[model samples]
Target: MSPIANAFSIDVEDWFQVSAFAPYIDRAHWHSLPCRVERNVDLLLGMLAEQEASATFFTLGWIAERYPMLVRRIVDAGHELASHGYEHHRASDQTPAEFRADLVKARDILEQTGGCPVIGYRAPSFSIGAGNLWAHDVLLETGHRYSSSVYPVVHDHYGMPDAPRFPWRTGDGLLEIPVTTVRWGGRNWPIGGGGYFRLLPYNVSAWGLRRVNAVDQRPAIVYFHPWEFDPEQPRVDSANAKTRFRHYLNLHRTEPRIRRLLREFRWQRVDQAFSDELEKACAS
Candidate 1:
């Protein structure tokens, strides 16, 4: 703990809605899938309460539409409510108009269900990169104050290696707070929470975040999903070996690792953790 309250976030989507499963799990069948989000989220909430920690939940409009109470529970528990778009479609794959529509639909549903204005957005799969820089302007126009949608690392699925690792003010004045990464051997490597957290040892994740906080002197932003906490989540057997490995590896360790992280680090909602940068973005 570097005496900095790092930003902690949860992308509120079910296991079936993950991008890796998109090839197999049809959106049409999403409604039919047994949703474990509510239960898993409750489990997370209980742990957070035990640790007396707060986080930001980037919820889906589709989930909010069906589980309004879940949205309310997040708000009622003293966490910030934000949007993760209408569905799990990546912003990079959609036209600007489509992105705008998805963004608005998600924000509106989140505001209504959570009873608070949503100012933060995280593109599904960390999807807004160089090709979709235009998405930031749409976020500005749509009243989003900030985004944690960019990952400044090299990955097969998503990344923009040259992007700034810390929170940056976009041309549109929307603060773009990227997921945390650490620079070593002239490359940006992801240490931000997600599958990477599950794939790697807990000490490695802690070391990366500590380095970012100590060297970069900036509050690091990390993210996870409710499904990540549920090791028993329905296995997507249809997914390829790599996908299965990525999604299911070390599932049992995730909860305890998160618990240790909470105990060791000073975590806060994104808005609170990066308030100064957000204020600067607005002022600019």
Candidate 2:
């Protein structure tokens, strides 16, 4: 099996995204909008099933309430169901109490609907950086076993550049799995995930993944949102130029590239891959 099999993740959100679009799309308007979460998720479920692969779905709680069937479908299909907070709010914007409450509400809803323990988390916008690293404790207290929230690279929005690249224990024993990147000449570059996977040439991304696996000999965690596949999604009228560009950039190519990725790498849910690695670690 390709080593990349061990760390694939899927973020379940609508086309109106969190980080870039939050400033443009007001929270109040979210409910009134036609729900696209299920439609996009169905697209992904079909793709993954065709490849006989599974992944962790970090679902937004708001979407779960509106489309509980989608959450159940994910569980029924043997994918891991996990929380992506009640709303797409940045962890840094929330105080610990607010973050804890938001997470608890999300976890309760996801666990009840999915009929599975929601043990994984990926913060909206990768917002759980050094400023809010203490949020890790809140996550453990709320029953999450691992998080894919930290982006260990310098970016305009979010990153903790010095954070460990692989899964490592946080202060509260929560396993923090930073997204995968390759280090070259002391510079770390994002590989096949999110916009990087979308905007960059496919061959360049493939080589980046291959390089990381070759040097680290560890499974590289890659992530993408379901909304990425919805090329013809209704456009929300908004004024923030940056948000519009980030959300709409390369939407047409995302799904085809993702299909190619599935063919190239063995992919599975993060929790399942982690469990397998843990067993191997013990054996050795």
Candidate 3:
């Protein structure tokens, strides 16, 4: 029952990005930003196809609307289609009503285009923290079977350090599969996702993930965006220096590291991984 033997996922978004950097860029300007989602995702799909791997693709509804064929390709290729919200907005920023509407909008677009039950969600920027815990209910009501929206590690913008490290039942019958991390000394150390995955050396991320899975027996849910592999994306203006660094750093190295990761571990779609784990638990 090893956890490292679990799933891989992709968060589909433009290279311009989200979270702390959202405020700096104008909403209108997002349209003017280069459209790389399809091309970059196709590259990822090619890699996954080469490896004969399937992963959960938590796609932005906006992207799905523009690239319905891409959504079709993901599902047709056997990848799980899931929501990453409609406009990449944080759940905490919206009222409960707004959040519900956003989730519904995204789910409808995803299910219609992908022609599959959209049962998984990962919030834009992992925004479902303590302040927005009620989002769990919205996800359940919207027909999402599981969510990977909680980071469960301290960050300036998002996290719930007290949340469970492994997948657990949240409100109602919904499953909360938090992004993976390791508790070292007193602080939570990121394994292989987001800025930590891009900024660190490949071996460091691999070792961290191995350590977490070996000790906890919980699958290390690693995530990345298609834009991470696109080194030539247009640079958006940012007032904050730290935000700029986080968004732009290590753009070139991402794909190589991902290629290495595919070679190193067994990767499957999120739901498939969950099902396998449940079967193993039952067998035990």
Q: Judging by TM-score against the true structure, name the best candidate.
A: 1
Q: Across residues 110-182, which tens digit of lDDT does each residue of candidate 3 receive?
A: 9999999998999988899888889998888888778998887988888888888888777476788888787
Better of 2 and 3 by TM-score: 2
- Which segments of candidate 3 are over 4 A away from where they belong? 1-4, 276-284
Residue pairs that clash (backbone atoms under 3 angstroms), model 2: none
The TM-score that candidate 3 achieves is 0.93
**Best of the candidates, lDDT:** 1
Which lDDT value does model 3 have at 72?
A: 95
* Per-residue alpha-carbon lDDT of candidate 2 for residues 233-264, written as tens digits (9 for 90 to 100): 88866647766777778999999998988888
Instruction: Quote each prediction's TM-score.
Output: 0.98, 0.94, 0.93
Q: Where's the lowest-lDDT run of ten residues in candidate 3?
A: 275-284
lDDT of 3 at 32: 78
Total clashes in model 2, counting residue pairs 3 or more apart in sequence or in different chains = 0
Tell me the lDDT of candidate 3. Answer: 0.84
Superposed Cα deviation of residue 42, candidate 2 (Å) = 0.5
Any residue pairs clashing in model 3, and if so which?
none
